[model samples]
Target: MKYSILVMASPTAGQGSATAVSFARSLLARGHTLHNVFFQGDAVGNGLANAIFPQDERNLVGEWAALAEQHKIELILCISSALRRGVLDKVEAHRYERAASTLHPAFTIGGLGQLVDASANSDRLITFGH
Candidate 1:
């Protein structure tokens, strides 16, 4: 099966992010394909490059990055939500005259069109939220 996940919760506040990651891993282990992982609302913060976590806490950003890298998953952040939350790509940063872009290499800052594409292309679109 092909699955796409839409995550709408902040990584630090709830189980949404962790749940999505675990589900993705399980699906892959079961021989499924991940179409995409789309981050919206506070979830876009998951792709921020400057999040700092205590040593005791799991590194959500690093885990997500590893998933994308290892599984060749497409990680997309909602551009409007990300911009409002100060998540910027190099192009967005240049266009808005920002100091620098905070988007990580593991993810891409994109618009709703990507989500639409994912929904159309994937067999299932699952949402993880509060």
Candidate 2:
């Protein structure tokens, strides 16, 4: 099956993001293809380039990034929600005259159109949190 995930919680705020990550990994292990992973609302934190988690704790952002790279999956951050939370890609940072892009390279800033497209293209669209 082809699956797309929508994450709506911050990586550090609760278990939602972690749950989503585990679910994604399980899906992949079971031979499912992931269409994309969309980060919206506070879930945009999953794309932060400067996030620093404790040494013993799992780095949710890094985990997601590694998963995306390893599986060649699209990791997208909702542009509107991202901007509101100060998460920016190079283009957006340059356009807004920000000091630097805050989102890691693993994630691409996109509009809701991408989410809609993912939903339409995938056999399952699973959302974590809201």
Highest lDDT model number:
2
What do the candidate models score in CA lDDT, each in turn? 0.93, 0.94
RMSD in angstroms, candidate 2?
0.8
Per residue, candidate 1 scores C-alpha lDDT tens digits across 29-96 of 99989999999999998999999889998888989999999989999999999999999999999999
Worst 10 residues of 1 by lDDT: 16-25
TM-score to native of every candidate shown? 0.97, 0.97
lDDT of 2 at 70: 95
* Candidate 1, residue 106: how far the Cα is off, in Å: 0.5
Q: For residue 54, give model 2's deviation from the true position in Å.
A: 0.4
